[model samples]
Target: MNNRYSNKDVDVFAWFREASEKGNAYAQFNLALMYKRGKGVRRNDAAAFVWMRLSALQGIAFAQNHLGAMYYNGAGTKPDDAEAVFWFRMAARQGDASAQQNLGLMYRKGRGVPRNDETALTWFCRAAEQGVASAQALLGEAYAQGLGTKRNFQLALAWFRKAALQGDASAQLNLGLMYRRGHGVPQSDTQAVAWYRQAAAQGTAAAQRHLGVAYAEGRGVRVDLERAYSWLRRAAEQGDVDAQFNMGVMLSNGYGTHKDEALAFDWYQRAASSGHMLAQYNLGGMYAHGRGVRRDPAEALAWYRKAADQGAANAQFNVGVIYANGHGVPKDEACAVAWYRHAAEQGDASAQNNLGVMYANGQGVLHDDAEAVRWYRRAAEQGHPLAQYNLGGMYAGGRGVERDSVLSYMWISLAADAGDETACNNRKLIERKLTREEIGSAELMTRRWRDAHRTRTV
Candidate 1:
């Protein structure tokens, strides 16, 4: 609860005097913990073993747990899982909630005995009933996931609520998500923000990330760039890859701080090293654009390929673009088409657009206007600006489908509305095409989309 050792300032020899003279259980337990940890005493396992045994003999629950853990982890004692289980059972029987939870975990994992889900559940329930937040949360997960129990969402919600109310940050975050999405709890953004903020303030990484998102997007919490950036930065410093990538984005934007491309590069590198896919994609972009470092097409290609291999859609799309254009690697339209198709299947609109272009041009595979229209339509449905423009172009030219002037004009209007500048400008040449109303609608949609999904906290 506090700093690890409670008696950090006390002398061990003096403590031994008081402990041995009075046969103090707490003093014995404390001494043994110290000895086991070599905190204020020499690292002597035999001595620690004897002290722990003495304390264990005195029937101190905490001592029982410590002794059990020592046996479990072989600290100051020979490895003996059975003995650990014995001591743990002894402590658990005495209503030690931590011991109860430990015993449950042991049984579930078969650490000291045969795997017994029923026994594990029994011990978990015991600790859960004692108001151990971790135990309650674990029990909740077990019930919800049908791990040694029935899958019961209601039971999960009940236990999660119990643990959440107890100020367990993990439970608070989990329950907040449930509330935010109305999964087993009534949907309430306000309630979600309250719980998320509480856990975020307590330094929970996931909660901090969620809070950053909320602040950035003005969801539940009013838009606060500084607060969002601070929370994201805190999480990033804790080795959270997602946070690192988002923090990089903020650094790139000069929001609430100067735009420092080098810092952005550093954060991106951190996240990339940790295998954050988005960071890998962004890292490639940095190399391609020469934002923070010298431009190296080979390095950009390498990063894009790495992320593409991990099934990152944007990375795949970029890989296709670079390969097709011979920006980094030798010109290979076939390779570009392959990557674009892979990413398009994962719903990358840019990839779909590029794939459609390849099909229309016959740059790699056989030229097929029909396939072009198909791919363009897929991306257009998801509001891809370029794909919408191309799909409208196909409709107007009757390249794939039959000519229909009215339908062709309608598609151009939709493309312009989707924010395709080319589609809007071309409408001037295509008589009676997209009206002024379509362009205004497209602008509004694009702004909303950008604001709703913050690339970073800022």
Candidate 2:
């Protein structure tokens, strides 16, 4: 059996006596903290204020900071931002790093003072230089966004690396992103995978999800769908929204394990209940499709509307599909176009491609080939396969772009190689007219693209 009395368990009168007689600053501070936390003693704001004031008078920087927190948080007392600032300044001037960083947050959030990004950055820099991992990450965020200083990816990466090395999970994730994106340094998928693994091992669900994605895509390590699916499951179990959504899909499709629609629906429900927009959209899909439950268009529409209200692009597109198909409701082309437009505004490649098709066919909106071409181009830039084929056809036929058989041949064949049936038929037609050399060049590019993107599992 363990017999221990926490500092919070001490009798107030006994502590006061010992503290007053011995002039024990640590005891005084601890007693003050107990009062602040209302442990063992009746909660009394005035008493906490008096005890912390006494300890602060003894040059206890910790006590000063505690007082600052109390004032800042308005715990058991009137909110006094100015007093909070004063106490924080005292402790910060004493070289207290926690106070410095917290004060910086206060200034940044305009809690105790006007929002002064510069002051926030300066204080964060000071604390970061003092070897505070939290402050280092905060400084990195500031530099990354140009909040107070000029945006500097290099500097942000440096600070994030330093903090990440010190076991800061958020910093680790940021550093991993920089490695994956080649923002400050040359892209190193290997390094990104390493950092993500470290953070994931520390129980970071976001890192687990990203690491799984890297594993699945073979960004650095050999692709392993089993490992990716397992990692995603771990993150999903911990309530990670993105992981939950992705895991639901994997379960529904039997990507790395046995197909289990019931499990997929359960996971989707868990994530959607937490206000995860994508999960909500996916839940709606399951209901609409009758994959795991009886088909219920009303329930699907309700979930789709929830996700759309939260500004989820995929949900906006799904809502449009539901309206157009009259899934469990009367068909409404006007509403379909409206939802499609919302998804299109958010740069959803599928929505852009579909919306363009809708316009061209006059299914839900005005027939306009030019508008169709514009939307298709937008989707093409995002690597949407269908849009690439559509753009190639437009170029070849002079429908919405300048006629260019050479470019059309390249794109149509490119799409065909990626499994587009229509593009393949057009490719067969173009192959006979083109010289062998032109065909070879297009073939090489298509092969290269396929080779670069094919996900081979380990």
Candidate 3:
């Protein structure tokens, strides 16, 4: 009698029961599968385990692989990684492809044995060579990331293509990334979108997120805010952090949906809770400005601090401002200086300008004109109008260096050109202190500086 039955026929069940009870290994394995799947028999994990173990003991490689899965999943018995490894090894030694893949997974995850990438790669290679799609994908990732072998984008692409053709979602996602980044293939946003669509169709959250970004940025297709919102919502619903952040931005700006600050706040809160730095910073802004929630400076500071801890320069600057202005806490210039310095060292123009003020006024440190000039120059070079005006004042007073009326006039004129009203008035006052030649020289310097920066930005 055939061991496998296609239908839930009563006679077939009886025949399998009889043969299984009579010590037929194939019949036992088939009966176990039927019980496990609730096909010809009611789903009974204990019965499945019993029959599977019996068949496995009879040296059936397939039964051994199934038994290992049962133990690993705790379907019929307490989860036991060691026992799972044992059975998986038994079937693997018999050249069972599934068993080899399972063993590789165990090694890769350190579930039943010491985490060993080399061993995992070895087993994955064997199973991949035998045409296991998942194993092929795993091997591809290993090669791409140099996990257990030298990084080889060509080999990774080959393996990913093999598994992707077999409809592996992970392989398709990786292949899309490879194309997007030009790894072992010419960069092609269109090809990246094609593979991303394939993987997204299979419900891969990462691929959905990528497809959403591609739509939003018009990389591979025409800019489609509606489609971007749709794909991002799918991935965000699946708990993708980046997608959640993007959803917040879209909702806030009414990109594809109606403008809804409340919804934007909720999405930002979700992503912020997940440790997304940008989300945290945005959430702080929402709280501080009463955009979607109550205006709460304390809450804003809390969120800003969280992002600041993650090295967000904007958040650090905000934290410094909050401390300096006593927005939600006691006014502490020392704390403000510390936070400002943190952001300043990271090249935050606003923070650098603020730090210069703190130093010049001796609010947090001893008054140091030279130190103030140093920081003001850094921010001024970045085209911060306020810093340029302040640096010009330093030159006019000779606080940091020898007084130079022409240089001071040039800096003040640059600030005035950038639309600083105070600088504009100050430039008029400074013009009276210069000769015709000095004024002409200052104007020429200003023009040269503006042209150089304009060219650099272009």
Candidate 4:
């Protein structure tokens, strides 16, 4: 019924059969490709493998490379890394850039070859010099990271730039980072954004995430929160864990859109499920506050602990709170003190103040006035109002060191200035007992301290 065969309906099988009878390697390879891709032929891996082997044996470099790939990927035969390596090396020695790159990857990953970065670098250099984009990118990374090469930022930038100009998405992203960090290039947010835009347009998920952050912070362009949200959403949809966490933040804070606590929780959960530490911390807070889900203190503690184990200071502080408050757990002051100490050492102001209170009250740790003063001083210097009040009390009572009424008034005044109502009331009582000259000295001390260390809000 379909006898009107056009030029496209040539007898490919007969033509290939006649060429095969003549021992034509090119025709054999073409026939293999036809079978492999089911183009004008039935897709038969066994037939493809047979023809590919015949073509490869005739020393066709492309055929050799394809045969190696087929062996490596088990596309037309049983997977055989050793065979893949052998064929790759054969094709690489024949000056096939792609085969050289594949051989380098195999050596680097120790698949059917001893892991040798130097050998991998050598092969990658060969392929890169031939203008293979992926190999150029790999060579750039090797130089940048000193993997089988001297650390050379200039060379890294050069290779990355070459590959990026050739439309290599990964190289484009790395080039942007190098520009942003001023590595072998003048730090230029504008240049960074240009390269990031290129890679993001190419659908590189990491590049999209970086571009979103740049837009949000006005790094290279004017701050456009809506643009940031759009870019971040694109990356998040592609399963970029960090982008997912950022989406949660933007959604929760209503940045560039209406607030959606429920959606924020969902995004946070997605990232947290991927083992993102900050996402785990945010999820803990969501569970604690019942923002999108029902309040569950135990669930909050579980998430907090997961993040804490990864050295999240905020999560560590929350863990201390959970232990101290006995929220869905037995109240263990000692456990609370341990967790508080962990966070305090990491420069968490609230944790330092809480640790100071524990020492002052002999709650979990041994009662030591000096320890209390030390912790309180640490937090107070960071402009923590509660720490300022507690430190002032310690100074006034002479509990840790000699009584210093001037320092006590200075600290209390600072706490009051920061809007601590109790500090204001205490300052009023303390000022009545001071002479005019003493009050002047205290005020001068406060002014000097404030000038030296500007108070920063938590």
Candidate 5:
């Protein structure tokens, strides 16, 4: 009986092999699958490749698609993108949805052809119309971003919904983002959170990070710091830069756990090393203040410069202060002025005030009283007390504007109200110079200015 069963099994294998040898494309394709999967045959990828190629050459669309995938993935042969594209094109022309999607990816990435967003979009549309979930998602992203056509948020939302309903994790994550940002749909944090939960369960790192932030801020959910930390840590461990930065913040502030500056520093270092601008800035602060690490001015300057190069205004200001004070290097007033100007142009009040001082003292550039007044006025209008005091002094000295005792007294009085001790003394001294009528006008001007400018927190 064992011998008879063994013979029957041999005959079953022979039946397909016989037909495959006779140039039957279907039989050849079936034989290849059997060889590849070791179903009723010993596994042999090389043999599978041979049979698959034969079937593909005979115009079998399914076999052509499988052959393309094999070449693309280097299965049973060296990877050859050109060959993969050729086979994918063959099957795609025959209306094979899988092959169409594969061809679109190749065009999109320039894997086997010149990158062409328009062509990729065309192929993706064909595959998506045929109900390919991944193709639908890709089409949605292209529409959302205006890759090959005008941006159409409604179309993107529709495609994302189709893919997300099919359980595509990436589609779910993007749908969540759209809902959260109110793009193409009414803003609904609850709906966003619901979709994020689904994608997070599937291990989508970006979705996990968003969900954690939602929990931390009590958006769409009650405040749950513990849950927030847990989700953030998961995404952080997956190498998500934003999540890593958030982890550092949570640890430093002891928001969901015990304060651990050491761990915070570690997280900040990881994100900074990955080129995160905010992480670099925070790392510099930790080094500058000796928080969770040894105080190292040089290290602080290095990190600050990295962030400054990435256009962080605060980092530029910090870099200026370091250069001016000779903290980590020789004092370079010229360099300090350059860095200060960078921050000042970005509307940094402290930087504007410092730049005004530099112009007044001719420390880094030629002394220009008008330029000093220009910067001082800008800062003063933003409620900088020191700038107000400096502007008052300039008026008193007739160094920037026409000397006006009433204007000087008014500015000095405004600075005094903000608790500038020097300005208070100067105001009293200036009062002696002003006539009683001038003093009354100055007092009235001070009251008007005070009412116009609400106190601004630094």
Candidate 6:
């Protein structure tokens, strides 16, 4: 590969043929380059392979490495991995850094050799010591992941920095992640963004997406929706699924660009087809509301089911609603209960409230006031307004537990504070039932509950 070729209109082909006939290895390599590149010769991979093999037999390390690559890639010959390993070993023994890195890759992948991380690490180290950028990146990953070495974040960071300084895009991206996560280095969003920008400029899709998110969220930089959209669009155009979903959200919400439901739906569809659960959920809502596409209950149900299967709580709740309303599917109270339970188990407050309603009315589950109160209390603790109002009614009527006016007032007042008009009206009526001391106790209880819930959320 390092051999020089004359391009001064000389008859280089004739000169190579005469020198090759004299058994000169360098001349054979030059002739092979001519055949490979069609320089002063017709392009012929077979001829190139033949001449390279001859030079490689003369112990020319670079020629041996080229021959190995040709065999490995089946260029001008049928693929022969074992033969490629043989040639790579020959060149690697002569201190060819490229061959050493290639051998390390083969050993790591167990291609034509037993998988041996230690051996792979040894070869990688050899190449890295010689300043091979790719080998340095691989060494960094190996150290970081504890592959054939003890996990060493500092060493990993050092190696990544070396490769990044040499313009290795992957290393730059990994270096950014390390800085973002404070692995071996102090957490610094500014440093992370700097490295991400370097990799993003080199067309690293993941880096572009991360950089876009950082810009949009004002992480280590001023919030710039336009810049975020630009970076995310670049990554999305490259078929990054997460970027596609993000682009859909931004477009739909008009975050950094004009609101474009049609474009948002397009991106959501692309991501949904790739099995992005959130995209499926969003696409289902779009279909349900006729936002960007024709309103179609059946299509909406189909998308919701896909997301629900992936454990999306909102999708599960939507599925329950569709079944209960008989929209696109047969009205099945049993199916509604099943979907609602699924969402409720995942802590969906709306689903919890709906489950309580179902239990209280015997619509889906057995009529059990105790179960209803239990579900209502779960939702109310999460600050669900409807559930708090419902719980207040239960406590006042003694439907599930003994009547406690103070508890009833506390629940209703909490709901009322959240702007529930019905609860606000009921609280005033309940206020007349309590003594002055009871009202004070109820108010104190509501404040304590609010503080506890706020702390839990934070």
Best by lDDT: 3
Residue-level lDDT for 138 in candidate 3: 96
What is the TM-score of each predicted model, taking all chains together?
0.75, 0.70, 0.91, 0.90, 0.85, 0.84
lDDT of 6 by residue, 57-135 (tens): 9999999999999999998788999999999999999999999999998898898899999999999999999999999
lDDT of each residue in 1-458, candidate 2, tens digit only: 11243444655546664875488777777767666665666556777777777788888998888888888888656889988988888899899999999889988999878999999999999899999999999999999889899999999999998999899998998888889999889999999999899889998999999988887789889989889899998898888988998888889988788899999999888889889888898899889889787789999999999999999998999889888889878999878888988999899888898888887778878888899899887886666878889878888888767887777787787678668998889889988888988787777876675576466210
Candidate with more favorable, higher TM-score: 1 or 3: 3
* Model 1 C-alpha lDDT versus the unseen true structure: 0.82
Q: How far does residue 305 in candidate 2 sit from its true spot (Å)?
A: 2.8
Clashes of each: 0, 0, 0, 0, 0, 0
Residue 301 in model 2: lDDT: 94
Residues 330-416, candidate 4: write the lDDT tens digits. Answer: 999999999999999999999999999999999888998899999999999999999999999999999887798888999999999
Clash count (model 6, backbone only): 0
Off by over 4 Å in 4: 1-28, 41-58, 74-83, 455-457
Error at 102, model 6, angstroms: 3.6
Residue pairs clashing in model 1 are: none
Task: List per-prediction Cα lDDT, in the order shown.
Answer: 0.82, 0.84, 0.94, 0.93, 0.93, 0.93
lDDT tens digits by residue: candidate 1, 1-458: 22343464346645664776588777777776666666755556777777788888889887888788889989877899999999999999999999999999999899999988878989999999999999998888777677788777778878988998898888888777877878777788888889898888889998998888788888888888899899889888888889899999999988656899989999999999988888998999999999988898999998888899999988998899998999967899999999999999998888888899999999999999999999998886676767777877897789887764445555566667656687788766764454666555544654564465445211
Q: Candidate 3: give the clashing pairs.
A: none
lDDT per residue for candidate 5 within 1-458, as digits (tens), equals 23433565556667889999999999999899878886667778999999999999999998999999999999888999999999999999999999999999999999989999999999999999999999999999999999888999999999999999999989999999899989999999999999999999999999999999999999889999999999999999999999999999999999888889999999999999999999999999999999989999999999999999999999999999999999989999999999999999998888999999999999888999999999998888888889999999999999878998898898888889889999999999999887999999999988888777767534
